[model samples]
Target chain A: MKFRMNPVYKKELKISVRTVRMAMIILGYNAVLALIGLLSFYFTFNYSFNNNIDYSGILQIYLILAVIEFGLVLFVVPAFTASAISGEREKQTLEILLTTKLKPSQIIFGKLLSSISSTLLLVFSSLPILAIVFSIGGIRLFDLIQLMLFCVTTAIFVGSIGIFFSTCFKKTVPSTVFTYGSIILLVIGTLAIIAVSYMIGVRNYDNLYSASSTMIEYNPPGVGHAINLLLINPAVSLLALLSKQFGSPSYLSSLLSHYGKTNTVIFDHWYAISILIQMLLAVVLLCISVRTLDPLKNKK
Target chain B: MLEIQGLYKHYGKFTALNGLNLELKKGELFGFVGPNGAGKTTTMKIVSGLLNADAGDVFVDGINIRKDKKKLKEKIGYMPDFFGVYDNLKVVEYMEFYASIYGIEGKPAKKLIYELLELVNLSECAGNYVDGLSRGMKQRLCLARCLIHDPELLILDEPASGLDPRARFEMKEILRNLNHKGKTIIISSHILPELSQMCSTIGIIQKGTMVLKGTVEEIMQQMNVSNPLLIQVVEGQDKVISLLKRNPFVENIAIKGSNYSIGFKGNKVEEANLLHSLIENDIRISSFFRQEGTLESLFIQITKEEEGEKIEV
Candidate 1:
């Protein structure tokens, strides 16, 4: 009951507000994305009111945007958070803090949460733009909800990874470089694997003559299946949201069918399982970070 | 109260502390003086639970450091040589951060932080960002941070190493104040004069071994036992020296400047008799003081023996 709300979280939150660059980055990014979305809306409405000439296509556009946003978060969160612990070490302050009554778990969790919150602020800042996109209709609340949830979960997981690396390296630069490096490897490596798997799977020798006419559709290499593949990597937890929301039969063509998943409860979303997995992995990594940072072991 | 028994620490094959033993009573301020590579910081680190000893037990207020280490940490406060700070954070917020670590918050936390800042004389700088503060301010704030938990023992490793003259005086005053409040403090430094002024007892460790430890006066007595001492007087220097030469307690005497350089003998009662004889000789003694041994002098004397002899560790 006496758990300390991480001072790291509070300090980070304060710093996030005070720093000019944080505001510029978060606000400026959302504004640019919003400007693009609004300009597209103007062009579409000006051309035709074909009843469906609304934000129906907006989800796909923003889904791509979501991936970009989450990708940026994945790369940036670690750079910011990975140095949290090691920064303390470099400043030579970690020793004094360790002497406090604070538990190691509390300190690590606090640092992780602080980093996640800063990254989450960027995700949350895009809410008004998202709301504008929804003004044209066809965008369900569940879509936005899933988007928010995935963004938070992915940031938490990535932030945990960052903090874990921070604990491993005593200096800030190496921890930061290593954290960003790992994220790049995770994101790109998974994408490369999925692409390769889809390429090989689609290359059936029996359909060689048909392969010339074979068009990858309904389940494009870059769409639903690719989205599903991203669920395993915490860096792309946000992609699972698009898969859950936009991969529906209503959103996609009825050409591809999968049981028990094409139609999911609107409220009791199945993607929660993937979200939980990502959250669990983050928590576990954070626990390991806490353990590694325990100063008594270092002294020995 | 603090006790470290058989503390042994090694970095690879290089031993830092070899069978080091130390004790301090409640409300006692002990100065730990040693040359570089003398294991003073290593000993302080282990005792503070910032480091673990290879083979030893550290107890603070009768509580073992290893058993429920966090609880022991609550009883001990440590201020390393260089303290750190957070970005864009006020002095009050910095204190609150550590206060929260100790599970103190809200009104209780604010009250404590306010009091600590006031104690460190940084109360006016409560709203100022830590980065904007001066080095001396940071040092004082660090001291305040350590005392946030109202800890029983403070383990300071070279707290005054980089401080300027005024800042060092401020730090000494703070330590003296804390010691006056009956707090037990173990401070490690290489400065002999500051330790003599501040600490009631002193421990001199050389190359992982504590060469000497006791009350400041007691240590000086032990270190300079039977060593030559000069008793300076204003006038009648020859009469005092000749009179003192006749006494068996006086080994011999040499007149230096206007004072008598008396080679002191072993017995305290004999010294008292010699002093009485000087008074009877109408020697208007300007100053009659024994040459007090210093930590610096002893450290140089002891460590120099093994210096440059190709020490394996």
Candidate 2:
């Protein structure tokens, strides 16, 4: 696809990429990725390579690397965007920028694009380390492509959350805090609520009938309820995607397997559905941020 | 040219602007002088399209600011009272960034950036980081940034605030040059003397309303102090006072430290006649001349009149 450049995006990229701090961040990010990959390799070789060079261990290494990349995306993307708008306000530059001819959507899109681009640089920099699985026999190139796409989508989604809060709050500290808080709510809090709902549904079903009755329970209410919850839960969907990749439930999704099988239609399609949900979230958040920024527009 | 009519704004019940009406003609250097919290910044923001007005219409070259906000952005260059710069950007790069925002690119943008740097007297420091510049230099750089797009109208809110005397003088000179170039400038400041020197017209606002607006001479005439004649006499002070009071051209006698100052309404001939009368009376006159009404005095008189009008109401 052809790229239509935004001036704000171009300028922000120039400023960020030219900084010594960005150089150091890229160096540090690669160093951490290299160190983790080496350690995982050492452990996998010491245990499995002594007798049999098992391909299963290589797949385990790929999963470890993917999880590490995902964790890094969660921690790094917000740092770029949480202070995107609030920092401009703090530096006393937002007013001058607002007076320019650019629309509010261009401003927000530029911030998000710059942030996502920075994180993508880090993600792509570690591709060689993730490429170690190619020497082994388990992971395919298509799997790696899917993994990278997932990382990019995750960064866009998380970065939008940061930009949204940055516009809502006046100070950078609160905006950053609330951005991380939102990630936690999406990842952990959603699962906790779904679990509680599943238990409550099962308890209500049992209460509706006597325990000794020989009645066959068809597709229990709790299992269907949990499946719906997992369908929308980003963390769960991510785990489900990984489970489908390795032909077994990953650690997180394993805990929720009693509610539903990974091969079910919705579970099998979790990756596409999760990406759709994240894209929708990014658009909604960016709209709110743009509306909050332009004073000439209606407040409500 | 710009016109604002029936402008009203309130922040949580505290009125910032109340039915404010103001107009500026093309090629006019209008000084917007007011006390703190008198809505100077608010009015400028509204004109610049940076803030929304509750009930108002700001027209620039016959285009409504609300309807064509983007068109207003192209016509007006706004320099806020307080601002900042990106530390990572060089002076030249900063200008280029803004030029690109206006859709000027490549060679044209580079030429404009160099021209702007020269205009602001920062040609030697084009490669220097923006955050490394001194406050005066930064102010000039911001002014250069505002002119990158060659906007017709410049709205500067307290451009000289927090500057040293030398820096303030330099800023005043720059503004004078810009005004001489036929740019319509609306500058707000508390420095009355500076405004008097640089601005052709002055508007004084109080409590979110304009108290008076006109040329210096017109405002002086409105204040009834068009020609205040001051005379000093060492001897026959009572005779001098009596003589001035009896003359048809002299009125409002005020005395201080062996000097008599009175309001005189007449042409050069009448002024010379009054002086001759003082001399013929043998009042031992020490000095005599008409007092040029100052901006400070006009401000004080307008505020006092407003106070009186409020009390009467």
Candidate 3:
């Protein structure tokens, strides 16, 4: 089969590449990452040298860099993708595009791919700064590759959320606000729900214990199935990935175990499962965006 | 090459198109004219597949639009009334983008882009940024973009709405040349006189329906039936008035000096016969003809009559 670049993606790439804004973005992105990496390296070395400790503190720099990059992805991906469709509408070019032979799915995917490409550009350009840990002995090549893969998966997931809201709204501002709002809901709202459920479970267990006659075997309350809700949260996935890389998978498991005793396999593979779940949700959101982008879908 | 049957569209309680019907043959330069909110844009959008009619059948080249929209889209190129150009994109690149959408790319796409640019007389501005161009240039570039696919039918809504006279003239000439090249074009504009001059057939829509449709001369004649006839007599003005009053086709007559303006409800043959009768009676006539009706007048009369009917209702 012959391969053809989607026209929207091609045009967006052409235009974006020609603009100085892309250059500035890459420069600024790298500058910030390098600054943060240097600061973490300096502080870790200062603390270690004063105590006459080994250079194992370089690993902390890697963790700090990885976490900051993850935060950047979560914060920046939406700004790129949230205005993809609504910008076209605001510029009044969407109708002309609709009249063409391009399908709605093709357009949606084109916008998504373009936004993801921009994000990936930012990610890959800062690799040098991220690779500063390689000079030391802690982070391996496979781990770096895994981190990049995780970043990409998170980008696609958040980018899909941005595109979904873009298709739902006609203006860029509202689409962006709603996209950030949804991210906040996923990051914080899920945690809040689990917290509330855990508290309720604890209260119920206390009532049961107090109302029991004679003596009873003490069992702590857990959030039970509600802990599974965090599977859609990227932040938790990042923490799981970091904990595993830091050679302490128990940190994440213990943190999650406070809420509930989950299947050991799930905790053992939390990163993979969370990544899979987020990717599945991204697909669903992209499907909905494709449907929403269709001009004739609402016609009776 | 195009047919719309019982096309109905509504926006909440307001009906944009109410059973609107229209058809066009191959190589027709059809002019669509309507007041604001008359569903001109709605019909054009529906035909372009950018919009869906509430209920109707739109066929292009025997392909039902609802059943086979992709095929319909393949055969139609639509330029909306209001469109914007992408910043940082050159005119040639813009054309290339649209051309690629139709699956024309590489060498063939480049060649088509230049050809369309030349057609729209923007060949020299190919490398210039689209946003830097003037409004008329942007509009012409849009027209060029739509033609990149070489679609059989072009739906252009108000292509010359905001253009100056020189630009309007250039646009009309481009459309005329496109029509000459066997491309069926449906263009809507408020410039009625230009439409009358360029369109092989004109359709006037009002209140979600096509109130008038025909060739320029046919429409003028249709509306001129109610137009008065002016007759200037060199001699025997009273005799001319008396003869006009007795004629069944003449509803009323008004005299100002030697000229008589009569409300004449007669076809061309009857009008000729009336003139012949006056000449046969030895009433020396300097000139006798039906008042020359303009498309603007006919449009106003039709829309006004509809408005009056609505008021009465």
> Which residues of candidate 2, in runs, are more than 4 Å off?
A1-4, A202-223, A249-257, A260-265, B220-228, B234-238, B247-258, B263-273, B279-284, B304-313
Residue pairs whose backbone atoms clash in candidate 3:
none
lDDT of 2 by residue, A1-300 (tens): 644479789999998788789789889988887787778777777877458756577787788788888888888899889999998899888889889888888888888899888888888888888998887767778888888988888888899999999999889999999999988888887777767777887787777655546777544464553455555456665686687778775554556566544456555566787788788978898898999999788441
Candidate 1 off by > 4 Å: A1-4, A18-26, A47-56, A193-231, A234-240, A248-276, A297-299, B231-265, B269-292, B307-313
User: How many residue-pair clashes does candidate 3 contain?
Assistant: 0
- Model 2 error, position B35 (Å): 0.6
DockQ, computed on Cα atoms, for candidate 1: 0.55
| Per-residue lDDT of candidate 2, residues B1-313 (tens digit) | 9999989999888988988888899888999988888899999998988889999789998899999988999999999887578877899888888888898888998898888888778999999999899888889899999998898999999998888888899889988889889899999998898998889888988777877788866665555446578888877777876787788977588889798778787766888898888778877877877777778887776666644132110
- In order, candidate lDDTs are 0.75, 0.82, 0.88
**So what's the TM-score on candidate 1?**
0.82
Clashes of 1: 0
Q: Report the lDDT tens digits of candidate 1 across residue range A1-300.
A: 655457767766776777798878887888887877777677767765665565466665576567766776777788778888998888777777777776688778777777777777778888777766576665687777767877777788788889989999888888888888877767787766765665564555335645557664434232334435445565434434565566553322221122112233421343565577667878888877877888775446
Per-model TM values vs. the true structure: 0.82, 0.91, 0.95
lDDT tens per residue, model 3, B86-168: 96788889888988888898999888888889999999999998878998998999899888878999999999989999999
Model 3, A297: alpha-carbon shift in Å?
2.4
Top candidate by TM-score: 3
